[model samples]
Target: MFRPAASIAGLITPSPYTQFARAAYCHGTNTWSCEEACAANSDFRVYVTGGDDSDTPDFFVGYWPTGNAAIVAHEGTDPLQLLSLNSAIQAHTGFLGAHSRSAGVVLSAVQKVISEHNVTEVITVGHSLGMLHTIAGC
Candidate 1:
């Protein structure tokens, strides 16, 4: 499982670099927070993302490379998130389907990173509404 930077110590120290990384990931949104993590500590690079079924625009994606331990974060409020949530709602009851859809998107992004970077392992981290995204990344 991937651990969110907020949960881990030393993974994200208080610094300007961490702030910059978080800002990038949030896409200037005030809703989410970001911190530095040990992406390079392991032999793989991990990507994470999050979304809410109720809203289409609160989605985010993050990337961390094991080699450099760098974090890249992306977020947007778009129809893509809505479509994913809609698909989930149509297939199942409650929020399970929505979560599944969000996870799928996150996983898809992770796969791309793996293929591009030749990553061997992948870790995902999401908090609150982003938990589904994290699971999907895995």
Candidate 2:
């Protein structure tokens, strides 16, 4: 008897990229490769990530060409933005806004993208410092 492929599909998450989009989006040349992959998959060209030179932390969001929602992920503190580490230290129980200014940049972009693309759902992914920003922003 043959079992349906779907029986084992649950163990795997379908992803076209060889690595997580977060890693590709965070790096330099890999970012370009990830963009190419996205382009090939669909006309979906929309992409936003934490600024390389800006004070904001690392954040990434991408949408499928035909999908109405998207998933955003954050990477570790960008080496260029060491101040992010300071902000993280200041993010104590009563000081959530220590980095609100920087976070605003990413938050604003996220809002704009969602509204512009009519995205209805947003799933977030992150690790370490990135995780902190995601939790604080949302």
Candidate 3:
């Protein structure tokens, strides 16, 4: 799946900061701990991060000062999460009760951070299952 850089030279690639943010997104898929990943990205400044693996889905909201927007980072799936551990779950448009609430929390957090920072817009990123929410406009 690896494409040579030379072959992709004509294609527009992600910026340095975009790549950094993706790293944080990937980490969210596996861990709720955003500190290390978010902190390591110099282009982003960690504003606030909170999530619970037991019920709530994990999210990271940070200010992308350079990009003049807030970045909402979410994960796809974390094996440690209770909902993910459940075997009876099935993929559907209607997420479980816990997932619904978690989505609400993530939305509110993104709104609060963007308003507080007065960012022009938000750049959302996710890895794995996280992409589903993003695509669903959640």
Q: Which one wins on lDDT? A: 3
lDDT of 1 by residue, 1-138 (tens): 333466556575633333433343343233333223323122323354454425321344433443333232332233344555444355224345555555566556756776666656543333333434334333
Model 2 clash pairs are none
Candidate 1, after superposition: displacement of residue 73 in Å?
A: 8.3
TM-score of 2: 0.53
Tens-place lDDT digits, model 3, residues 1-116: 13335556435665433454455434442333445454455566665555564454455666677777777765556545445556787756434544575566567766877788
Q: Poorest 10 consecutive residues of model 3 by lDDT? A: 25-34
Candidate 3 at residue 12, lDDT? 63
lDDT of each: 0.41, 0.51, 0.57
Going through the candidates in order, what is the number of backbone clashes in each? 3, 0, 2
Off by over 4 Å in 1: 1-25, 29-53, 66-92, 136-138
Which regions of candidate 3 deviate over 4 angstroms? Answer: 1-36, 78-89
* Model 3 RMSD vs true structure: 6.4
Q: What's the TM-score of each model vs. the native?
A: 0.42, 0.53, 0.58
